[model samples]
Target: MRKTSVLIRSIFTETLELINISDVVSKSIRCDGSELIVCGRRYDLREIKHFVIVAAGKAATPMHDAVVAELERSPHVWMNVTALLISPTAPRHERANVTFFPGAHPTPNEVSREAAESTLSYLSKVDGHTFVMFLMSGGASSMLEAPIDPNISISETAEFYGALVASGLSITEMNVLRKHFSLVKGGRLAVAASRAAAQCTLIVSDVPSHSSDSVGSGPSLPDSSTVQDSISLFEGLQDRVLLPESVISFFNGPLLTETPKQTDKAFARSFHRVILSSTELAEAATRLAKASGFHVEVDSTCDEWECRDAVKYLLDRTEALARIHPRVCLISVGEVLVQVHGRSGKGGRNQHFVLSCAMELRQRHSHITVLSAGSDGIDGNSPAAGAIADWTTFERARLMGIDAQSCLDTFDSFLVFKELGDAIMTGPTGNNLRDIRILMSDHEEHAIYHEF
Candidate 1:
């Protein structure tokens, strides 16, 4: 059991290396002479005299630094180069011509609104000679904001977001509401900079790769989700806790506005590339698993699935594979939805997922190991990134007098996992590509199998 724990942790940590911010940026973007190349789209910087960079979300700081490294190494001269980074943390260090603005996450605050205000103002001033590079990742949805209705105060805006979180809706459904509520989301960010020479968006995608525009609420991409869509989703909210009346009223009132669409002029010069995503994360996990002598399979179809359903499906797949091979590893990348009930406990979707697996794996007598963790290195309200569990985890918790079901019932997987020393702690890896779940097993002595 101890060796299984060690092996899964090793695989998870190594898997995160390939998707780091520096590597993602360097591989997807570069500058040669007077040309800036990103995702194979080249911009001749000789004619474009100004360059504007806006890096936001969890990876904002490192993404900014990596892009600056490229810019600094270049000998090409520009009339002016300005950069702004909006992140959940305070500035780590100051760089010339770069301004760092601190913002909130999982919720919005005054700083978030101010950051959005500054960004809209700055981009609105850029001329046709300026080429904008928007480096976006996961947390930008809350790290940058401006409400469409001035009557909706910052508190109201934050409360609205909190309501969406507790609503148990998928991220896409939640962002539908966010896009209609914010001034900068749903392609409005690109519209504000419509006058710029050209703009390109490079995403370290936490959302599904097929819906990369959903990252950070599609700040640069055209939004297909509409205000009517938000109203419909909002109308169906089962847990409307902390939902503001003003937000609700505004959506139903005259102030409601539709998001920018494919026909919008703002997207005419816009371009995008998904630099990193679950696909990359799954590939890395597969390579590591194969090198470790396991028959590996990848299934991301469970993405955006409810946690329990996702666990059952993945575990079932692993069991079938383990029957055919001496050693098996099933790799899954993407987030599972966790719907909170009543007041929540300290845990994220990943921890909740591992705890769920422990319940199913209890008394199974199999050498199976499961790991689910965020690449960003944080999970929900807890400090631990995620956790690991195996066949022994349940009895181990029971021996320690920790009730797995009760903890899970209260959304408190973090407490049980921490007490059992199963929590994976990696502080702020400064990257976001969503979550990864690795399920693997071995046929060994004292490892007989049974099904739930």
Candidate 2:
């Protein structure tokens, strides 16, 4: 048990190290003395009079710092640069050319509005000689947002976001709804800076592949979602998800606005690259596991599935794979769904997911271990990133007077994982690539708890 524990944790940590923000940025973007290149697309500095850098999301500060650091290498780029950075937390750096604003995540605050206003204002006045770059990532939908309507307050906006988080909808669905609700999202940012000579957006995706439009609600990219789509999504979730009254009325009312389409003029000047995502994460983890002598299988098709269904499906896959190999490592990328009920307990989706597996692991009587965690180093409202569970988890909880089923039912898995010393902790990683679930199985059909 201890050997498998160390192996999985080491693989997880090494996988994270492979996705360093500065390293990824340095490789994807470069600036020569007279020109800049992003993902092989070059822009001549001689034709541009200004550079506008607008960075927003959980990874905003790091992205801003990396880009600004790169720009500084070019001759006189800082003097002609204007940047507005909105971070999920307080600003990590203070620069004279960059206006830093701290915003809230999982919910928007008044500060988010301030940040959004300043960004739009800065973007609204760019001319053809100005080049704009947007650093977008997860959390931007809430961390950098403004309502299309003047009557919507920050608190009400926050209430709506809270409802969305609890709705258990896929990130794609939630972001589609966000596009219609905000002034800056859904290609509005691109529209604001449409007069600029060219615009480039670099994204660290936290959604499924080819869904970069969902990242930060695609503020700098063209949006295909419409008001009708949002209306339908809200209708589907309305029975169990109690959205704010104002939000519901706005979505249903005639005043709601439609998002930009593919043919929007703003997209003509814009191009985007997904700099980092779960694909990179999966590749790194798979390499490490394969090197460790385990036959690895990766399944990402179950993304956005309900927590129980995802767990069951993956466990069955793990067992089947273990049958043909001496050892098996089953890697699943992307996040699972967990619909919150009213005011639930103190666990996030990752920890809750691991606890659910504990119940099944208990009955399997095999040497199977599971680790489910967020790549951002946060799992819901809990202090830990996620949790680890194995077949011995249930036996240990019983010996410690802990009720595993109660913990899972009440959404209080954090407490049990903490007591069992199985919670995965990494603080805030400042990077978002969605979530990763690693299952390690050694097909030894030993007896249930008697060996311990």
Q: Pick the candidate with the highest TM-score.
A: 2
TM-score of each: 0.95, 0.96
C-alpha lDDT of all candidate models, in order: 0.85, 0.87
Per-residue alpha-carbon lDDT of model 1 for 151-206, expressed as tens digits? 78998888888877777788888888888888999999999999999999988888
Give the count of colliding residue pairs in each prediction.
0, 0
Runs in model 2 lying further than 4 Å from the true structure: 89-92, 443-452
Candidate 2 per-residue lDDT, tens place, 152-230, comes to 8899999888888888988999999889889999989999999999999999999888788999999988886777788
Clashing pairs in 2: none
lDDT score for residue 9 of model 1:
95
The local distance difference test score of model 1 is: 0.85
